[model samples]
Target: MTPQTQPAPAPSPTQATAGTRRGRRPSLGAVALYPATFLALLVVAWFAVTTTGLVQPYIIPSPVDTWKAFTDNPEYLWGHTLVTTGETLAGFVIAAVVGVLVAVLMVYSPTLEKTFYPLILFAQVIPKIAIAPLFVVWLGFGASPKVLVAVLMAFFPVVISGISGLRSVDPELLELTSTMGASRIKTFWKVRFPAALPELLSGLKVAATLAVTGAVVGEFVGANSGLGFVILQANGNIDTAMLFAALIIMSALGVLLFAIIQVAETLLIPWHASRRNRG
Candidate 1:
């Protein structure tokens, strides 16, 4: 006679505890260690290259020299940093606002998308630097041209990503909302806008970095102040250490802006898959 086999017994508390331990993810500090280690190694290599005279001081200044350059002209550097920062911030805000509105209009109207998308692509293709001087001529050497350059640099990414995000809502979900007799505007705010935030944030991160570049480019073309101007002056004077210091500040600025966007993304969409994965 065939006998029915008994089901396997549930795991014991001790076995379940061991399984949980084995499946545990690395802590945040542990995850951060890898980048910290690499950065430390890079700094060590930089110091060695300069201190050992492998590269001339004039060509590649030591970290100590770069630090001294900043200390030597604190006010000058601080003022220029503020100017560039303002330009970058203004450009980013304008891009985010105008780009999103344009994206919404385009998404709701196919004809607008077809008409403007190619024009945007065309504008993006033209070298911003080449036309930056024209803006200087139009708006003068003041901050307006620089801010405009930043806006142009940041605008494309926002519009592209905004359009993509706004249209990516699940059609079935949209239909479900429609069946519930929700107004189009109500459906958009409650469903589409929230659904599109992740993609929009992704674009904003890219635009943030590019905004720095745009501001610097505008300064390069014509500016009485800014990190770009400092770099240019340092190059003219053959002050490699000062140039390096300005470059370091610019890099830090870009990184800081990008980090701000990432924080906003986390706060705004804690439920997004990207944030969940990081957690």
Candidate 2:
């Protein structure tokens, strides 16, 4: 009689997902096409509306005028953009470091989590604009206030996502690590942190965009420089083209930060399900 053949073991969920992604992975150009098409359509509509006088040029400046505005004073705008970018980066770094630390502490200590979670929620709910003045008052009319506001705006998501990720580790895996005589720190570094990374990165992407907004809001409260200041000045002078240009630059800054975070996520968590799906 012929020897009976044994069936192969089924692939795990992660492996299966990775296999699917490998099969369906799209080219970079294919991935970019949809957004590029949409942008082209939007530009076309913008040109049509402006040229046809459907919207007053004063209210929404023509694309050509906006481009001219940016080109006319590129240096001035670039300087202010650099200032805002600095504030945003500073605040994001602080928020990310502090948020991760707070998350770790809360995870390790149930009492701390119970005590501070409500306060954190309350702080998040209060409008940043209302509190921006307080920061300006306390920190004065410099970059400090802007950075502080950015930290506040970007902190919540990091903490929430961190908590969710830290808690998501499998109990069985943790038990195995413990049985193998791994220290708590080792277990956390090797297993918990990696497991938590996907959620943490998601939160970080959101925080990155919010940091830009926070910096701008801080500028709105009382800043002499930054894109926000440029926007304010353009508004006051009724320079609609300059205002549109400033707004466009501000949006681009946020998108840039978001894209950087997304690249980081892709590099850091290539094995995560979300990344696999995107692949």
Candidate 3:
């Protein structure tokens, strides 16, 4: 009797690419190490360059100065942060609901798309920032204008992505479903809709991230509250430290909001691409 040997399987493209790309699955220590090292090097370089007087300290504050500023007026900064957070969240919710509805309508009626696509294209072309002042005049210096601006900023990508997702259903599968005497609604709900989901979710993620940026911009142009308002006030006061603090806060808020959307999308479409992502 002879013993047989089984050879090992080859590595997948993803596994090979993952090592080259993300590398080592990113443990918490590695996560802390990279940014800390980069920032440390950056700080050292900054200290050397500034101390040498190549760039004045007034022009670029030290990392220590920025840290001091962040801790100085934590209470005052917190209030403005809440305002910006509110605007970002409100606009994201509105955009999500409207984006999905518009996508659904567009999918159901090609004529609706023909009627509306040009309008959306035109709206997108007319830069939101340019008409931000007009929004103030029309909607006043309230949160409504800010929310509207954010919604406009986030809407287009979602619609386009959703439509593309809906249309991406496999033709053969659709034909098979149709031949099986499925109704248009039934086919779409059971087959096409599920098929389109991952793409739509991906688009939603993009839209969610953009919405935060738009909300901040809206507040910057017109409002007496929120981080944008805080930024304006800090600029006026020449309070560099507070301004830097507010900027950091605004960035953190954006990242947090984007993460929330990703979480929601994962929860909603748990059985889809995200599951494969976990695997």
Candidate 4:
């Protein structure tokens, strides 16, 4: 009698997931098509409304008018954009460094976490805009206040995400590392930090955008230069086209910062499941 052939083994979940990712990987053009389509629709709607006089030109300038505003004084706008960008970057860097360090400290010390977490939450709840003027008063009407506001806007999310990530390490894995005679620092560096990166990077992306808003808000309070200043000037003079142009530039700056963080996440955590799935 011929022996029955052995049955094939089922694919493991990991193998199945890997196969799914490979199958679902999107082409560059496919990935871009959705946003491009949406943007085109928006442009069509905008043109229709403006050309048909459904929306007043004073309230919502035509695309041509906005383009003219940019072309008219490109250098003036560029200088202000650079000023805002610098403030945003400076604040974001400071917030990131301080936030991570604070998170590490709180994680390592239960007493510190217990004492400071509530206070942190309280501070977070207070409107940063309300306190922004105070910073302006203290730091003066310069980049200092804008950067400070940005730091405040960005700091909380980083700290919260850092705490979540740091605490998520498996106790069993930690014990195993300890049993292997690994130092706490070695385990943390090799295992804990790597595990924490996905959450940390997510927080950074949010913080990056908030930092831009904070800079603009501070500029609104009092600024000689920046997109916010340009917007304020255009608003007072009823230059709707220039106002729209400044708003667009401000939005672009925030998007640019967010995209940079996304690129960083891709580079730093290519091994993570999120990154793998995206790929």
Runs in model 4 lying further than 4 Å from the true structure: 1-24
RMSD of 4: 3.4
- Give the lDDT ranking, best first: 2, 1, 4, 3
lDDT of 2 by residue, 171-231 (tens): 9999999789989999999999999999999999899999999999999999999988999
Best by lDDT: 2
Find the candidate with the highest TM-score and give its number: 2
Model 3 TM-score, all chains together: 0.80
lDDT of 1 at 107: 92
The clash count for each model shown is: 0, 0, 0, 0
Ranking by TM-score: 2, 4, 1, 3
lDDT of 3: 0.80
Per-residue lDDT tens digits of candidate 4, residues 55-84?
999999998899999999999999999999
- Sum up the clashes in candidate 4: 0
Instruction: Name model 2 segments beyond 4 Å from true.
Output: 1-24
Q: Which scores better on lDDT, 2 or 4? A: 2
Badly placed stretches (over 4 Å) of model 3 are: 1-40, 43-54, 180-183, 264-279
Clashing pairs in 3: none
lDDT for residue 105 in candidate 4, whole number 0-100? 95
